[model samples]
Target: PPNGAFRGFGAPQTIFAVERHMDRLAEAIGMEPIELRKKNLLGVGSTMPTGQVLTGSVGVEECVRWALEDSDYEAKRRTLGLANKPVGGRKVRGIGASVFLHGAGFTGSGEDRLKGAVELDLLKDGHVRVRSSSTDIGQGTETVFRQIAAEGAGVPFENVSFAIPSTAHVPDSGPTVASRTVMIVGSIVGHAAKELGERVCKEQEAGGGSFAEASNRLIEREGPVVAHRRYGHPAGVKFDDATYTGTAYPAYAWACDVAEVEVDLDTFEVDLLGFWSAVDVGRAIHPVLCRGQLDGGALQSIGWALCEEVQWKDGRIVNPRMTTYIVPTALDAPPFHTHLVEEAYEHGPGGAKGIGELPMDGGAPALAAAIEHATGIVFDRIPMTPERL
Candidate 1:
């Protein structure tokens, strides 16, 4: 198998290096690490290395500030050392923070080329059927898409239905990668429903009626009213895929994570005490779902950083069984405190940017920074096991 499919995809590795270096730079300059990160943070009008200008929804500063306050970061840094002052048996506690961003949706002009699409059919019973190849892999896609379809069609949510994703039944809405299911496909679903609504209104009897009543009349007369739409980029957004210089992503989601850890000097064990995260999700379509993504992704990253590792013998399998392969369970997890910041993206559906992968980018680096603060050791490698510690 290829080295992919993990949450965060390619971001956690680079973020680990970038954030760990920030601490090193702060130490070299005798400056507070948080202050250093703040000074270098990206804001509105900042240009990414890919030459994309962040026009709006750049909420990283707010994310960092909220994470710090929620975690009592500064106060903990000042006082947690006192908690470590046992005479012979010594343990050190430390807290660390990281602020970062994940590009939402496909890179550059990928969405434009893909032209993801959706179809809506108005049935004779005043119900709408969404026809799209967007699969719900437990990220609440069906719920969110149904909400979008209902709002666009001017019907009750219960009146909207989603066809199971099958090639013979649904249009190609592109693959469910790049965190674009809700942001891209849901937007198309909304537009298609709206178009279907307009068509129904135009074909129905002239007398005014509820959307359902109008849809019922139109579908009865016309057999079934159908409308389709494809995604298009917001106007004036330009990208040259050949040059690889343009809007890298239609929008970005920002986040900051703070990790609190206690390291035992004698045993060389690191225990996560607590974790705090603040995310700027553009807007959360569902608050509970958003928090679940953050908490789950954070735990996954923590496992990667602290314990999950694979051993190889002669380039073959070793410890492949679940019993031997270590992974973090509920007992290993710390209390997760998560905050959501809404900075709307004009192009997003209901002002939502991609969120599923954003939490994965911050946790490992934050945990590594916490370990460094606790032990004065720079851990560049992950899975910072007892032997490595």
Candidate 2:
């Protein structure tokens, strides 16, 4: 009944709430919501509340540009506004859009203290092994881990072994939370692989042998060919916890979400027709995997905005059963269009940033923005069900 962890961390709920206010402000001032968003988005030189300056490869503008053009948000919004007039089936259509910046790692000064590290082993058989405390909790951590490890180590994917996260055997790569696995752990892995790969290459050249043979010889002589790397913040990155001021994150994942919803006038029920999102996640280590994360996070956000309400009385759960608590199923999911923008964070290995929670960051706000044109009501709260309508 209590949400321990969900996609977007706390972003879906907070963004949904914030986007509602944005819509209200836009309507009150007679400004197009999208235009308002465009004017206010943080760009290359924006400063955070904590006074940290955003540096290279910021992609919020790029994300918004692609989302607007690809979704035809303006044309569709105007067309749907015209269709908001009384319809034969008592149904009205609306398009909503939202954008967000989700930080990729621990809030400032945190990573400096974290000092995450990753250790790797090159086996005699030529397989690479990654050792870190980043465990897979069904978020494709295993698949992506292997992908980065093998690619960084210059080995075939089949030759990589992803070790189970063990405190005794593996170095503490920090928690697997805060969307840091790829941006932080993956970077560490890549660094180690690069070092090891370089060594292997040098050994191969010196001995005039294959990579496996060279690696085996090195293992025998060196008593285990291992590469180890520690976390290092980009130069001049600092945070003051006492004042809660400093760089909020080492990097940001910029994203835009466009949602299409059909509102039934008679029943006041909402049906999601389609969803689209554009994101700059540094560079996707694996494009298909990134798309899946986006689609899944957006779908989860849709459910939160529409029907996934938890009833409670005095902090006691009233409806905990699946039959009572609503979540998105395949039947309830909308068609998805996911796009990627590549703005490389300078420190990220292979130009990758963490994006495990970004798609969910913007979905709810986008949906709420669209619903205003269809229903003429500002959604101050979410799960816009028939009862609330």
Candidate 3:
């Protein structure tokens, strides 16, 4: 399949492979996979391949501990051992868990180098509009941006409007990928709004009038009260482009996915029963929206793990249309519970971090782990179709 930015970007696919390996390793060594993972887990103060220290809000350990408790993992694992009994003929159950850390923004020095910018304008209609080139591709980009802008500017959310994404009207807040829209770009928007708010208040104080009156006065006199900001690294942030060193991400989003699977022995049909995701996205600007991201990513990851396959006819994708291609629907998606753990990124807007693809990082791994447990099979590749089984 041609690669593009999906919900978890590259994470779901990558972790699908890693987590499968984790389960295989655990079985080989005769230990519970969770115990093995816990021993090797990296938490706060751990260093990365780039040698950057995880200094704040690291929550992977909490995610593992909580997911295990919430899922009744140990007891469930014991019951799966009963699959050999005849009461559950021709079917086997497996529970698997996976954990991963996803960088919230660009890989390294990306924000510093990109120098993304944003603008907030006090409109003539007593409303505010934010101008940034972050497009909404069904990932709640516009809604989340508006939320941050409204809260940061201290204005009513209804008073804020989302502008169509265009370079002519909006500034370059960089691309909408790499899960950067909320943390890196939204932070820029928040900073710009904060600056705009301060300017408006300063005017109100000097002119001895209400906020609206002062805002109008400032606009009329100044030709438009516009606040603009270019991205600047929060103090002490630095990276080396030449060496691939230094902070890979300004903040990391951590998650753990626990999956339960039931396999049909006769048909090799893999059915996902339940999935739970625990994530520390710093904080959620909109809890409902955060859950939406988590569910959507998990469902897609499930498809990627067990069902999706793109046949090629010559150079074209055979499944070019949804009519021919297979994708998961509401009926196919399992019941997924999302647990948000807030440690709060100090640099993020309203203390909320980016989770655009964070949920994507762990699902495949967990699913593959569960599949392995059920079938006693260690398949190396995905799209674990019936034929492959």
lDDT of 3 by residue, 1-389 (tens): 57776676666667767777777788899999989999999877889989899888888888888888888888888778335535758888888888897888887777777889888998754467899898998888888888888877778888888889888788888998888888888988888887777777888789867667777887898898788888887887778989988887888888888999888988989889999888988988889888898899778888877888788988888787787778899999898878888888899887777788777677777877787778877777878888897
Candidate 3 segments whose C-alpha is farther than 4 A from its true place: 1-3, 7-9, 81-88, 313-316
Give every collision pair in model 1. none
Q: Report residue 387 deviation for candidate 2 (angstroms).
A: 1.0
Tens-digit per-residue lDDT, 62-173, candidate 2: 8888888888888888888425465565888888888788888887778888999989999876778989999987677778878878888798888888888989899999
Flag regions of model 2 displaced more than 4 Å. Answer: 1-3, 87-89
* Model 1 lDDT tens row, 1-389: 22657876788888888888888899999998998999999999999998989999988988988999999999887766534545675788888888888888888888989999888888865689998898888888888888888888778899899999999989999988887888888888888888887776765558568666777777667775788889988887778988899888888999999999999888989989999999999888889987888898899889899888888889876878778878888788899999999999887878988988888888888988888777777888888998998
Off by over 4 Å in 1: 1-3, 81-84, 203-205
Output the lDDT of residue 333, model 2.
Answer: 84
| Model 2 clashes, total count | 1
TM-score of each: 0.95, 0.94, 0.94
Candidate 3 backbone collisions, by pair: none
* CA lDDT for candidate 2: 0.83
Candidate 2 vs. true structure, TM-score? 0.94
**Top candidate (lDDT):** 1
In model 2, residue pairs whose N, Cα or C atoms come closer than 3 Å (at least 3 residues apart or on different chains), thus clashing, are 96-370
